[model samples]
Target: MSARHFLSLMDCTFQELQSLIRRGIELKDLRNRGVVFEPLKNRVLGMLFEKASTRTRLSFEAGMIQLGGQAIFLSPRDTQLGRGEPIGDAAIVMSRMLDGMMIRTFAHSTLTTFAAHSRVPVINGLSDDLHPCQLLADMQTFVEQRGSIAGKTVAWIGDGNNVCNSYIEAAVQFDFQLRVACPEGFEPNPVFVERAAGRLSIVRDPREAVAGAHLVSTDVWTSMGQEQEADQRLALFHPYQVTRALLDQAAPEVLFMHCLPAHRGEEISLDLLDDPRAVAWDQAENRLHVQKALLEFLIDPAYQHA
Candidate 1:
């Protein structure tokens, strides 16, 4: 049988995605209760990072250890991939010795190329086009805090970057209504917009998007490798900031989330992280639990029956 890769949320059925979220919640509970569950015992994961990260690195590494598995962290300096090695060659060589591989990189094509040659499952930790793993955790956090997000209204305010693209994908898979507010030139990919036609809408005004929204999310105005464009992005994305007043336009119990390492006063209000409406902390922590469940779904034999 061919290995199941998790390069995008589109890779799984809607039922499978929901199951993973539920299982993530259960895993979190088990961990809190002092339960020891190590389904991936003896397995190894190879993590390749072409981009720098904090939460992505720590969550996957820690989750692997908790599952009685080991994870190898490979930076550009640590691998030949940085020294002009083809992704397919690296995938073939690494997959031979690893149970699975997770890559955080720039081009989306790199992941597709790697997965095509990989014998084991290849997970996209992050790519220039999508961040499916983070969506897993975001969904888990929402479910844990506000119940099923099936029919809720989610407002996305900021640059239509990778995370925004994944949220566009998430809206289709998770059955939510998404209202995106971004600058004219910063809108999400037209392909994703057309794919999510009825389920999503794009607007210029943040107030309009947040009005009656159940949950709100945003990411840094400028992501890694885009530092050179920071000043320009700041001026362009200024109107899309998620402030308390903007969030107030949403439902009374509306929640706010950010895929952290946030630029406090930039994409979001400086006080937003500590506000009662912001669940960024829990959302950040869920990265571990959801990823652990993701690892099991892609690796554990028992998960076939689950």
Candidate 2:
């Protein structure tokens, strides 16, 4: 049987995604209560990255250990896939040894190509086009604190980068309305907008987008591989930052979120993370929980061997 791949939110049915989010909350509660659940014992996850990571690596590795599974982290220097090997060939070889694989890379095609030739499930850790894994955690955090996101309005401020693109997908999969406020030249991929049908909106003014929003999110003004355009982007995105004042325009119970490694005084106010409405820390921690749910779901029928 062909393995399921999570290259995007569209890969799963809406019901499956919701189940994962709820299961994530249950897993988090179990962990907090000191209950041990290791459904993936002896399973192995191979994580390959062409990009630098802190949260992604830590969360996946720690979650694996906690599940009684093991994860192997491979950097560009540690794998033949980095030194000009074809992604398909690497995936074919790696999938034979690993139960599943997660890849964080530059080109979205790298993930598609890899998954095409692999027997195990291939997950998109981060790609040039989307960051679905992060969205799982973000949605989990929102659901835990504010209940279901269905029919709610979510505002996306600043650069319409990978994380923003994932939000676009999440809006459709999770059944929420999304308003993306970005600079003129920074709009998200048009194909994604088309996929959202009427569920997503793009605007130039952050305030206009955040008006009466239930959830607000933003990412770095400049993402990895875009350092060359940082100054220009900074100038264009300055007015797009998510500030306490800007979020105040949202609903009274609005929740603010950033996919972290936030730039203080840049895409967000330095104190925005400290505000009571900002759930960045909880959002970050949920990465571990949700990803554990994801790992278990994709590699289903996990064993519980010591």
Best by TM-score: 1
Model-by-model lDDT, in order? 0.93, 0.92
Question: TM-scores for all candidates?
Answer: 0.98, 0.97
lDDT of 1 by residue, 120-187 (tens): 99999999999999999999999988899999999999888899999999999999999999888889
C-alpha lDDT of candidate 2 relative to the true structure: 0.92
Off by over 4 Å in 2: 302-306
Regions of model 1 farther than 4 Å from truth? none
Q: Taking the tens digit of each residue's C-alpha lDDT, what string does model 2 give over 127-162?
A: 999999999999999988989999999999988889
lDDT score at residue 140, model 1, on the 0-100 scale = 97
